[model samples]
Target: MFKNIKNDLPASVVVFFVALPLCLGIALASGAPLFSGLIAGIIGGIVVGGLSGSKIGVSGPAAGLAAIVLTAIGALGGFENFLVAVVLGGIIQLIFGFLKAGIIGYYFPSSVIKGMLTGIGIIIILKQIPHFFGYDPDPEGDWAFFQVDGENTFSEILNTVNNISPGATLVAVMGLSILLLWDKVLSKKGKIFQLIQGPLVAVAVGIIFFVLTQNSSYLSISSDHLVSVPIPEDTASFFGQFSLPNFAAITNPDVWVTAFTIALVASLETLLCVEATDKLDPEKNVTPTNRELLAQGTGNIISGLIGGLPITQVIVRSSANIQSGGKSKLSTIFHGFLLLVSVILIPKLLNMIPLSVLAAILFIVGYKLAKPALFVQMYKLGWKQFVPFAVTVFGIIFTDLLVGICLGLVVGVFIILLKSYQNSHFLHMEDVSNGKHKIKMTLAEEVTFFNKGAILKELDSLPRDTYLEINLLKTRYLDPDIIEILDNFSVKAKERNIDIQLLSKRGVIENPSSFTEFFRTRPKSKLSLS
Candidate 1:
């Protein structure tokens, strides 16, 4: 890790700039003490980073859990009680890691995973727009369609436009321009350009703008436009900040419920981050999902103990890390150190940097997640992959993240079943034997209940008085329901005076009287088509 410190240090600095405001924003959203987010960020960087198998993935208090955290804190009656749940949630996740439940992450379709990243990117952009303009009614990191404060996401945007702060807007525009120039122009310059990141440049411009606007009467910028890191009056006050859980509340069933909720949701988000980060890795290194769960679990437990928000493998910070050229865990560790050092040495300076500048930073992060090119690329992969991917995207955008994913998963399964039905048995006319019309029915491999409709249609479509051969040799597994359908078809065949031959592991027999009964008489091992 020390070997790449030169490269990683710069990357860490970029990630630190990005992570700082988000730490505060997410803490505000979680309804925990403002410093809790910082604690989680520190733990995510230091603890999770140190233990994690992932080289580039960053862990932090995720926006995805803000709603749950807010509700849990309320239901548990206090932040301290919620802390207990967070710790318990971590222990549960650790158990999950030991159980090897992380394998589930690998099963998600690549198209859906890509869509998730793209969808999140789009959401990040939409969410940061208000902040960019200095309208921050919701916390800086909230990313839901409906905010915890009862405002619809789109409605909040309209409200922000109407109530836009001119000073904040000016700072935001300036910061954005600086960031754009640094990336689009300066980055192309020479060794010096590569040494300084866009976020750092934008931040410096933000600080200078703050100084220039010190006289609020003359300038559009005001104190409200500035970044607001929680200020502790003294060292003693900072130490007094930590909250202890109400052990009495731990007995409440609701506490346990909240714990399970955080455990499940946090685990899911971590798995998603692991998947998304692997895609962003230039080396194409795979992250160990189970180990990631363990790392997250340990981080969350430590965070809760220290009165911090729950931690997860958060994509926002991780993506920022990747975009900034982070190569290893050193960047993550350094960013954590930065969090600790910033609060101790430069809390006042942090408070002076405008919120709009941080919003500009998030705006870039969001753009990277939801770029339009991602949509076009996914569509080009074909409908089988695209439909589910689109569904997940819309589901997340229109509804909530989990709901959208469930909807997409359901639609994806439905399509798979439809395809199976289409590929299953069908009727075909064979050459007439001595003018006696002959028909053939071919079964698909691994026939299941999903294929019953197609099989029935083919069976019913046979011409009356035609000789039919029902072939089951190719089928690997036969559904009992399908066997019943064949039984009924055989009875109907006799009534229609249709001649039929049955082909299976059993000797080829002509006009079997009872399809189900005949199958029962055959040896069970021999009858299994596979």
Candidate 2:
């Protein structure tokens, strides 16, 4: 983990900066105590990072689960009750890891996965727009098109435009300009630029801007424009912030429901993070999914034991970690340590950071994820891939994340079935010999009940007064359901004045009246009609 300390340290710092505001923002969004997010971040970075098999994936309290957390907290009666669920969720995740459920992540199509990344990227960009203008309504965790506070995303942007704070806007613009300049122009110019990371530079400039505007009453900027880290004046007061969960409510059935919710959402979010982090790795390191599940489970358990929220491998921070040149898990671990130390020791320093400046950094992140090029590329892959991809993108943009994915998955399955039906042997046209139109219907490798509709359609559509040839040469396994379909088609074909030719290993037979009965007890063979 420490093999690349030189590169990793800088990366850790960048991730640290990116993670700080997110930790606080997610906590605020969850309606949990503000420190809960930081606790999760610390645990995710230190505990999960130390245990994770992933070299580049960064873990934290996820914005994706903010809705669940919010609802769970209210449903369970308090934040403490929710913590019980979080602990149970960790236990469930551990079992999932042991069961190897994490392998499900491997089954997603590359196109769909890419679409997910692109979709998230677009969401990040859209979400950060308000933040860039110093307008924070639902905090940093709410990224959906419709916010929990009943405001449309686009409308919120319009509202933010009308209420833009001049000081925050100026700092944000300057911060963004510095970040872009450092990344696009300076970073490539020389060693000096490489040494000073863009996000770090942007954040430092934001802090200085806040400090300079401090005493100026005439300045439009106020303390609210800066980062709001909770200040603990002394060592005694520092430890007083942690809130212990009420363990008496642990036996409630509602706790279990909340646990399941967290487990499923956190696992899904973690799987996405794993996939995304893998893509972001310049060296292309593959994180073991099962191990990652275990790591996340452990993180959650530890976090819940303390006063923290449930945790997952969050892509936002992971992507930032990679983009900033994080080379190892150590970078992730150090970032967590930084969060712990900063909040306790140097919160005043952290508080000087402007929320708008942080928003600017995330805006860049969101833009990269959902660039227009992603759509064009997906479309070029053909409709089979493009249709599902497009559906997912639109669904996510219009609705919530899970709903959009379900819609896309449903459409994807329909397309697959359609393709299967189109390729079914029943639809293939064959040539005729002599006066007999030899319609050769080569059964599929595996014909099942789902192919019934296509089989019936083809048989009913057979031209009248034509000889139809049906070949079961390539068929390895034909389900009983499909056999019934063939039997029905044969009867219909005869009535339509069509001749049916049957070919099998036994020999060639012309329109056997009892074709279905003949194959009823047919023994399975690798080369059935070879």
Candidate 3:
């Protein structure tokens, strides 16, 4: 993990800046004390990153859980009660990992996964638009279409025009220009540029701009436009930010329900992020999904005990890490440490860094993920692949993360079924034999229950007095549902004066007695079905 410290060091700094406002914003959205979000972010980074098998993936307080956390805190009684659910949720995730449920991530279609990445990218861009102009009406973690502030995403953008802050807009523009110049030109010139990341430069400039413009009424950036980390005056007050969970709530049935919900959602989100980060990795390193669950479980347990929001592997932070050149887990851990130390030591200084500057940084991250070229590329792959990708992107933008992915998966499954129906069997007309039509129907390899409808329709449509040859020469692992259909069709053939024949590597059988029994009793064959 330390082998790439030079890369990981700068990457970690960039991720830290990217994650700071998000951690605080997510806490604000969840109605939890702002410090709790920082706790989760810290644990997710240092603890989870240390334990995780992923090379470049990062974890923290996730925006997707903001609604659930808000509702859960109210429904479960209080923040302390919610903590019990979080701890229980961690235990449940641990059990899920042990059960090897990580394989669930593998079941998602490639199109859906790509859609998720692109959708999130679009969201990051849209959500940050208002903040980019210094209109901080809603917290950054509000991923839903409808906002708690009584506006939808697009409406919020419309509102930004009336509320734009001149100082923030100017600083944001300068920060963005620095990022573009550093990325497109400066970074290529020397190792010093790589060592000192563009985001850090932008952040420093934003702070300096905020400090210098404070007296200019029209051009000055206010505290409302800056990052807000809880400022602790002394040692005792610093420790007071931590809230311990009320373990007594563990007996509540409502707590259990919340626990299960958190576990299920957090696990699903983590798994999806693992898949996405692996795709984003330059080396294409695969993270062990089961290990990731265990790591996340541990992070949640620790985070909950210390009064934190539920934890999950988040794609935005992970993608930022990858885009910033994080080559290993060290970047993740370092960012966590940075959060811990910065909040404790320099929170006031942090608060001076304008949100618009961070918004500028995220704009770049968002564009990279949702690049226009990706749209044309997906379209070129045809509707079978493009439909799911488009649906996922739009769904995420319209609904939320989980809902969007579910929509994409449904579309992907429908396409799979359609493909299966069309490919179940190959039918051809052979030469007529003895005044009867000779029909040759070849079964496809690995026919499943999904193909049952197509196979049944073909069998029932056979003409009377037809000579049917059911060829299994390319068949392997045929479903019993399909076998039953074939067996029933054979019995019906007698009344129609139709003759039946079965052909396979085992040899041809005239009028097979029982298709179900035949497939069930057949010995395993080493012979090539292809």
Candidate topping TM-score = 3
RMSD of 1: 2.8
RMSD in angstroms between candidate 3 and the native structure over all alpha carbons: 2.3
Against the reference, the lDDT scores of all candidates come to 0.83, 0.81, 0.93
**Full-model lDDT, candidate 2:** 0.81
Quote each prediction's TM-score.
0.92, 0.93, 0.97
lDDT winner, 2 or 3: 3
Supply the global lDDT for candidate 1: 0.83
Flag clash pairs in model 1. 121-369, 121-370, 122-370
Q: Which ten residues in a row have the lowest lDDT in candidate 3?
A: 521-530
Whole-model lDDT, model 3: 0.93
- Across 1-530, the per-residue lDDT of candidate 3 in tens digits comes to 77899999999999999989999999999999999999999999999999999988989999999999999999988999999999999999999999999999999999999999999999999999999999865787987888998889999999899999999999999999999999999999999999999999999999999899899989998788889899988999999999989999888999999999999999999999999889889899989999999999999999999999999999999999999999999999999999999998899899999999999999999999999999999999999999999999999999999999999999999999999999999999978889999999999988999999888888889899999988888898688788888888989999899889888876667787787776666645543444
**Rank list by TM-score:** 3, 2, 1
Q: Please give the clash total of every predicted structure, in order.
A: 3, 6, 0
Off by over 4 Å in 3: 517-530
Give the residue spans of candidate 2 off by over 4 A: 217-220, 426-434, 494-497, 504-530
lDDT of 3 at 230: 92
Ranking of candidates on lDDT, top first: 3, 1, 2
